[model samples]
Target: MEKKKINVAISGLNNVDSPGPGIPVIRALRESKLYDVTIIGLSYDSYEPGLYMEGMTDITYQIPFPSAGQEALLNRLSYIQQHYPIQVLIPNFDAELFNFIKLADRLKKEMGIHTFLPTVEQFEERHKANLPEWGRKYNIAVPRSQMIHSVYEIANLHHSYTYPLVIKGKYYEAGIAYNHDQAVGHFNKISAKWGLPIIVQEFLKGTEVNVTAIGDGKGNMIGAVPMRKQVITDKGKAWAGITLEDSTLLDFAAHLFKETHWKGPCELEMIRTAEGKLYIIELNPRFPAWVYLAVGAGQNHPEAIVSMALGETVTPFTTYESGKMFIRYSWDLICDLKSFEVISTRGELKL
Candidate 1:
């Protein structure tokens, strides 16, 4: 009997410089016996994990942007189809998702690749902070916010909200603000740079908890993992994290999925005030930084997503290894470049 081969590919795997949340997604795909994975991305430089993947996967392709163009994307998809014939395509970053949406028709009809993404209107609605209005309709706690289409609009809406506002750009840029002045400053700078509409939000002070999960698009929950962050860096990356099982958060997350009809894996950042009110801050339509911690805990989110995409039954995973601690944004490695004699005799470096 021939072993069944499952071809899986992920986008946005370019080098590690500001590597997106796809790293763990790819790792899960590669490790799982469910599918043989092929990772794809564009990068100017090569690094550790990518280097390792280059040697392991069935295929690795680097297509430089603009130069890669629509033709190049189609060509790569075609070539991969010629060889491995991918069953599902997982887009990891905003740019790739945008491109996939643009070329989704061709990929579907011509190459027969399944791309998982929200509707264009859904993307735009959430992209421009319109989703929060939906959340508000459902009585979900969305911070008091304003949206600006131009720099001139900013002046009209400047004083409407209180201090420490979060100015966000369409789609991907959700970088926050600490004060009204800072919000305006960032709005002006980002507006000048990107020339996109900005959404200004009232900064909420509270404890941050991330709810990461997979949904079946029909208000059915596949798996949900909540994490309480211990240390978050200035760069907005988690450092020293732990997973928590909270039913209240799960209930809230189910409410969100029912409201949005969200499909696939997404991470929502929520804040809890001293009054114990939980407010939805923002949602990333992909995996989170500490997702590997959940993978380590036994959720197997990527595999669950893959199985769902393949029209397989995805059972709920309840027995997650609790009290799992993790450290992100930093790695400590032993220096094997020196001999023990050089270490002991020269400087007496402690282990």
Candidate 2:
């Protein structure tokens, strides 16, 4: 049987030490049984490795940074559309999601592009700065966290938080600070990268587990897969993970989607204490870099989201194989300097 052809565009191709979800998401899409995908890789930097990986992208275009605002983004997409006629766009960065979420309607109405993303209210409320209030509203247990714009707030954090607290950026990057000086150092570092209003959260002693799931605009979870990190990098990225048959974690993610009616792919970062209490540490509004694990375990969250974006109904996945493990590794791709020069200078490359 012939597959339906789709022009799908995706961003967040920076697969580095601290990777992005683009490569994994694209891999899932490539394996889709329902569609023949033409992958358009949207990138913010020329150095993003996925731009050069063989068989990864049909074409790649450099896009303006999120700081350039939605108008600039729309213009770029408009230019790309003239060439590829994008039918579905999946944006994977936390910082850029706000712009994409805001433009979802315009992209669809004007350019015939469809995106399955969270509503602006859903995006704003689940922000790290707003997680405390969001937890209370949804009855989800979240750690005590305070958003601060200045380094001076680190001193006052002692009043509410103890040592070994977690310091996180507004969009990404996080660190465990064992003392005041470390906290100051992390604040300066993360703030410089992701900008101010860093969040200081009470550190929970527990094992870190993650859930990657998708929802269909309504209060229905299409699929969810829970995984335990088997290997972690210094940057806190999961280098390896194994799928688990944990009902409590699955129930927690289901409840969250039911309450918020999340409309797209999301990753729930949770910590389970020795006594079995679970606390949500972070809620990523998009798929994680390890999302391919879900596909390997039988969930295929990216495929489900793409199906939903194309106005197809996806049946909820009830079971996935436990003990399915994914170990991430690196490879050296030998590409000539000319390939790099063309993409760097022209801001687009056709592979």
Candidate 3:
């Protein structure tokens, strides 16, 4: 059978120590049974490893940073569309998702580009700063957290939060601080990179588990796979993980989707305590770097979302192979400097 051809554009290709979902998502799309994908890599930096990974992207275009504002991003996409004609766009970065979500309708109407993403309300409510209230509204357990915009707020945190708390930035980066000085240092460091409103969350003692799931716009869970991190990096990213047959985690994902009617991909970062109580630590609005594990396990969430974005009705995936594991490794790609030079100077490269 001839597979349907799909022209999909994806971003967040900085596959480094802390990787992004772009390459993994592209991998899933390449392996899809339903679609023959032409991967268009959207990159912010010339050094993004996915741009140079052989056979990974058919073409790569360097796009403006999210700080450049929505007009700049749309203009760039419009130009790219004139050349490559993107049918579906998947943005993988937290910082960039806001612009994508805001432009979803415009992208669909004006550019005929489809994107399956959470609504602005859904995105805003699940923010790290708003997790406490989101949890209360959904009746789910979440770690106590406080958002502070200034480093001076760290001194006052002791009255409300104890030692050994986790300090997180608004978009990315986090550090566990054990004392007042460490908390202040973390606040300063994260605030510098991601800006103010650092979140101080009560450190929960538990095993970290994550769920990579997808939801259709109308309150149906299209697919979900829960995994337990076997090995963690210094940056708290899962270096190795194994799929699990955890009903509780699956149920939690289903309930969240039903209540919020969340659209597109989401990763629920939760902790299972010694008493087996689960607490949502964070809610990433898009696919995680490790989402390829779900494809290996049986549910191809990235593919499913692409189909959904293109207006296809997909049946829910009820099961995945338990105990399937993903171990992340790095390999050096020997590429000619011409590839780098072209991308750096011309801002586009066709492999």
Top model number, TM-score: 3
Error of 1 at 64 (Å): 5.8
Winner on TM-score between 1 and 2 is 2
TM-score of each model, paired residue for residue: 0.81, 0.97, 0.98
lDDT per residue as tens, model 2, 215-272:
8879899999999999999888889999999899999999988988988999999999
On the 0 to 100 scale, the lDDT of residue 108 in model 1 is 73
Q: What is the lDDT of residue 298 in candidate 1?
A: 82
Can you tell me which runs of candidate 1 are displaced by over 4 Å? Answer: 1-4, 14-17, 36-58, 64-72, 102-106, 137-139, 152-158, 171-180, 329-351
Better TM-score candidate (1, 3): 3
Ranking by TM-score: 3, 2, 1
Candidate 3: regions farther than 4 A off: none
Backbone clashes in model 2, listed as residue pairs: none
Q: Per-residue lDDT tens digits of candidate 3, residues 40-94?
A: 9999999999999988899999999998999999999999999999999999999
| lDDT comparing candidate 1 with the true structure | 0.66
| lDDT value, candidate 2, whole model | 0.92
lDDT agreement with native, every candidate = 0.66, 0.92, 0.94
CA displacement after TM-score superposition, residue 6 of candidate 1 (Å): 1.6
Error of 2 at 174 (Å): 1.8
